[model samples]
Target: MITARYHREIPQRYRLEAGKCKKCGFIAFPHRLVCPKCKSQDFETIRLSDEGKILTFTIVRVASDKFSKQTPFAVGIVELKEGVKLTTQIADVDVDKLEIGQKVKIVFRKIQEDGKAGILCYGYKAVLI
Candidate 1:
């Protein structure tokens, strides 16, 4: 279910669709209305590669208010081959085993919940391949 206030975060969950500027080779993750590199409105929708390299990471000892029960999770920025970097949760890895340049893949997952009566949110998370 969609659980974000911003519409841009929608594609960040279901599909890795992004916008590549026709004027320049700038890829925008979660997509862009205009190219930041060349200020071009002309763009092509591109699906990002599932594979990427972990650029940096951090273990969340103190989780968010929504994800408090899910503490000790890992989060990181991954650099795709398309030159787009995405920040997402790094799952299925020991918190003590995290390091820079770790190879990972984007996977669909449950991110958080609104409440007991609310929607079970979902999004793309990274898993060690």
Candidate 2:
């Protein structure tokens, strides 16, 4: 069973949908009701570009209980070609090889499972391109 919060994010998670502010040209992921840049409530729907570059990253040595089994994984803020900066798990690369400006592309993957019998949450992860 998935929580309401998770269910609400299905669109963004599965489709990489974003809302671009109609006035300021600012794009917000997860579809914010208010624009963070210019206080505008109007926006246009946009799909985020899958290709991007690693702006920054950190190797997670400690994680929450849900992700304990995936300890030491790398997470990074990737700036997509559309100029949207989003945090995502960096996958399929050695920690030593991680670096700023490394080219990456979005890949759909299982983010986590809520419980032993819970639903599997799938989302996009950044992978070296």
Candidate 3:
């Protein structure tokens, strides 16, 4: 069984869906029920653009248990074209080549597996453009 945390994030993880506040135009990823900027409950579901730029990043030399085998991976906070920023792993490039302000595009990829016989969790990763 998928964890409640993982299950609830399917929309944002799979489709890049976000909640845009109708009152103050604040876009919240993971679809918050309330607007952070204006304290409004009015929102419209919006799909975020896949294209973005790398705002900041870090190389993980030491990783968590789930990501142990993938140590030294590059992760970044990417700012999408629509101004929504999301954290994602940077893929398909060498760590030495990564830089801030680099253009990237989101691609669906396997994020992790639950266990030896567990479910495969898929999510978006940033690919250099």
Candidate 4:
């Protein structure tokens, strides 16, 4: 049963979500609504591993309005062990020392704000392994 208001995003943000295309071998991270490569409507939900490697990252010196208090936080794309590349905030890390190809593991953490009245959003975030 879907438990989130944003059910479409629940698989990706709240769980170790992944997508497998029925027509091709392309796998998508963040659980696409449709396969970008094949435009396939059929997909299988896969839970990814907690481990991954840092593909790239940057420090959010100028964070968004919702993330203003979290400015200068480290964020990056991590290619998980399942080969699904995902964008997530890098936690348990010092922003100044982060580097590419660093080993990481997934953890559930406070990901973002929900305006003034909404669920305190929680999602998968990566921490140094």
Question: How many residue pairs collide in each prediction?
Answer: 0, 0, 0, 0
- Candidate 4 per-residue lDDT, tens place, 1-129, comes to 223566657777778778788789678876677889989888887778889999999998997688998888999999988788888999878899999999999999988767776667788899998
lDDT of 4 at 37: 94
Misplaced by over 4 Å in model 4 are 1-5
* Residue-by-residue lDDT tens digits, candidate 1, 1-129: 354563546775689888888888788876779888789999888889999999999998997688899998999999987778989999999989989998999899888877889877778999998
Q: State how far residue 116 of model 3 sits from its true place (Å).
A: 0.4
On TM-score, the candidate that comes out on top is: 3
lDDT by residue (68-113, candidate 3, tens digit) is: 9998899999999889999999998999889999999999999998
**lDDT accuracy of residue 125 in candidate 4:** 90
What's model 4's TM-score?
0.85
State the C-alpha lDDT per candidate: 0.85, 0.92, 0.93, 0.84
Better of 1 and 4 by TM-score: 1
State how far residue 13 of model 4 sits from its true place (Å): 1.2
Worst 10 residues of 3 by lDDT: 1-10
Per-residue lDDT, model 4, residue 77, is 96
What's the lDDT for residue 64 in model 1? 62
